[model samples]
Target chain A: MAKKSFFKRITLWRYLFLTLCFIVVIGNPFTNYYWDINFIQGWFQSIGIGNLWVVSPLEGLESILTAKFFYMPSLVGMVIPVTLAFLMGRVFCSWMCPIEFLSLLTDKILGFIPKWGKDLKYRKDLVRFAKYTLWFALVAELMITMIIGYPMFVWWSPPGLVGRETMFYVFYKHITIEAVIVVVVLLMNLITRRMFCRYFCPLGALLALIGKKRQLVIEYNASKCVGCKICDKRCPMGIKPSVGESQTVYCWNCAECVDACPTSALKFVWRDRGFITLPKGTKGESAV
Target chain B: MKRERKTDRREFLKVTLGAFMGGALFSSCSLSDLKNPKTMVKSPIKTNILRPPGAVSEEHFAQKCIRCGRCGEVCPYHCIKYFDVKTGGVFSGTPYIDVMEKPCYLCMKCVYVCPTGSLVPCAKEEVRMGVAVINRQICVSWQQDKTGLMCKTCFNVCPFSGVAIKIDHDFRPYIVEEYCTGCGICAYSCIADTYPENNGKKAIVIQPIKWKKIKEIKLEDIKKS
Candidate 1:
């Protein structure tokens, strides 16, 4: 009998965590309705228990920009998420975001269809440019929020829409047009896997910037690697993990690549090893 | 590769410059211009639709609110509801109370739960959600002799009772606009709407006060109240 790898164990826990986050996001309204248990309230935009709050950093930043005033409670609410990003390198993208959970499900469902299942191929430079577009979108979103005097992203944020739609369904018995936005984004996963997380999500962009120097990171072992590129194929973020592309801030610490590495060359280590320097003879392909 | 890089850089520069120019144009148009009453883009305020207690001015509420839905979640009476995307553009997902369906009980739980100060915490008495206006024409008590019906449902159900509502010499209900909190309990309990003869019309209805119209409602007053 073969033993299970540590990465598999982490991936299993990630799935469980993601499922739990989905339930918490969508089930709060039902629990509030049926059992009257509302100790925990809110969704991805801002969730809290009692007085302790965990607000989205991007939303908090927008609030600060649009309101044009320093609000103490909201500022305090941002501390937890910002600190988590600092330590964990945007783990929330994989482990907590309900939209990411739905995206993963869409990926799985798409896998059954032969033609649609394959990952979309793009030029190496184009992929890098696409990654850079996340930053561009983030800046554009924030500036728009400031100019418009409202947090525009919150209006159509996938996870927020899911949470609100769930609440609306539970209470009002009708779904709004926001649900269509969520459905469209989820359906787009068929063409490009996790497109929103990779190049469009402003929250993910903000987290990537904050978690750029995160403590926990995927470390590559050159000696153990077989140059099989399975990890590259497994990465949802479209980065090659075996050659230390996982070290990029875009890597959400999902450990999908780690789990896919048959030789156990890639593992999450709690140390900031910085960027990897390529070996003497090996070419660094798609290093970004 | 060198030529491709040059074009890419040029494309990036063009995009960034365009975005900067657009942003500068928008910023040049002052906030006051956007907020001007003459602007048709302003969200139309409805009469019976009231913001939850302690809500800031409508202009600031949409800007400050992150739409966490905590206000609706914490509402004990479940009267607070969100505006959907179709009905609400900037106002979508923000909390509102439709008094005719279920009126605010003034638990003030929603105010405390709001992470942003879109709904500031305040005393129940100081909450000016709107003012209740009594329609004497349909009121049962006002037309007791003619209709042979004497009902004081609004007076009995009012949270402020005597202070917010008072009886005239003829025992007809009269709303004291100064003291009315506009919680809409009176409108919700009004018997005039229940009577088939009155054609389902509420005698006492809440007329929402525009946040801009109330010049004295400072943040300090909200806190102190």
Candidate 2:
């Protein structure tokens, strides 16, 4: 059987997707002319690529909640992201989140960090999945603050803060505290992988809650498996995607582990129709 | 592979319960708490801040605006500037026009471009962004060689000249607040441009304010009369 090259790996594809998203974010400002076109707002808003639209559900929620009056058009803008989550889980985190993009960049620059420390102290655990609780807290906070008639500043959110700063830094030549906070976020990731996306991104938390039950999930075939734990080592988000225990809610489907699996037991199985795996031609040879 | 967390789901659930309990206790506060004129916690909207035309009232506008920077991008005059920390407090990054620098030309593009109704959509004449107040002391017309004969140049510059602004018997420009859409063209076109003696000031200034109801939209004007 022919082996997949390193560049063609799933993680690499995810990185490529991230790169495409990055281009759109910075390139959007230049594209907006008078009224003909607009790029996505930023990390806090949509993720448009080429002519395709990828909306931000969180923006819609914030506008509706904080404004206390719903605008039909803005509410309609949210359908794409919500539908994507319903279908593919929170792939936005793995595929296109700017924070995830920043985390990967910083990880590469500080490449000497001993491969995410395999020690049990650094191993994936229940606490790592505690981001759901953080998500709950933010939504709860939003409700309380809205009830108080002074919605907490959504601009102060990590994505909003960073997105604004990125605009100014790239186009306006000024660095506000928002930009400074983004740098601080990057530095924090040195201590762990994607600390902001894992625990702080309210939007991500919102997506995780919505996309938890997506049928397009990572499934494990334990029968043909060796418990080598290589998947755990390769996971950037620290997700465990084996033994029916994958945190599909948090998995971006970056597919790093699928590439890393020596047994080749790991493959995307479309659960909608009983276990349809990819690379159909290769799957037959690998199974034999 | 590691010892269990010191703070477990039990602690998490306990906090969640506390939040709901606190919420219940607080929601009991009367509706009058919201209506009390003497709001103890000084609201941010008390001051009349000019927002882009089509904006909701200051109170609702502040909460609704997502600070997307879209309206600013669409303005031909580049009048809309996002409020940074220096100018905007909690309202930073929302769109506001600096009339003295560059005023809205009644392009109506910004109102159209607003993704959220942070800037509402309205006809050019219906837009009541703010009112342009002409300062007699600084006005060149009033100061022209100390002659009581005012230049009335402001009337020539006013977009809604005959209606929004007019000259009284004394030839002094008085803004008929009812017609003034506060497009800031008078300030932008002020003959009394900033001179060193004035310490960089114009004869007219657009003060951000919310006042009396704007007359109903003239639908006839919506189409060519």
How high is the lDDT of residue B101 in model 2?
68
iRMSD per model? 1.4, 3.5
lDDT of 2 by residue, A13-74 (tens): 78899888776666565555334464443344633333343346776677777667887656
- TM-scores of the candidates are 0.83, 0.79
TM-score computed on alpha carbons, candidate 1? 0.83
What does candidate 2's lDDT look like per residue over B93-206, in tens digits? 777766766777887876755556677788778888878888888786666666444677779978777777888776678898767888787877776655567776778877
In terms of TM-score, which candidate is strongest? 1
How do the residues B1-225 of candidate 1 rate in per-residue lDDT, one tens digit apiece? Answer: 999999999999999998896554333232322242422234434667878988887777777889899888867678999876556656678788999899999988888888889888887877888889888888889989877976877878887787778887777889877667889999999888777878999888887676534334334533443
What does the lDDT come to for candidate 2?
0.64
Candidate 2 CAPRI classification by DockQ = acceptable
- DockQ value of candidate 2: 0.27
Model 1: pairs clashing at backbone N, Cα or C within 3 Å? none
Query: Looking at model 1 chain A, which ten-residue stretch has the lowest summed lDDT?
Result: A119-128
For model 2 the local lDDT of residue B45 reads: 27
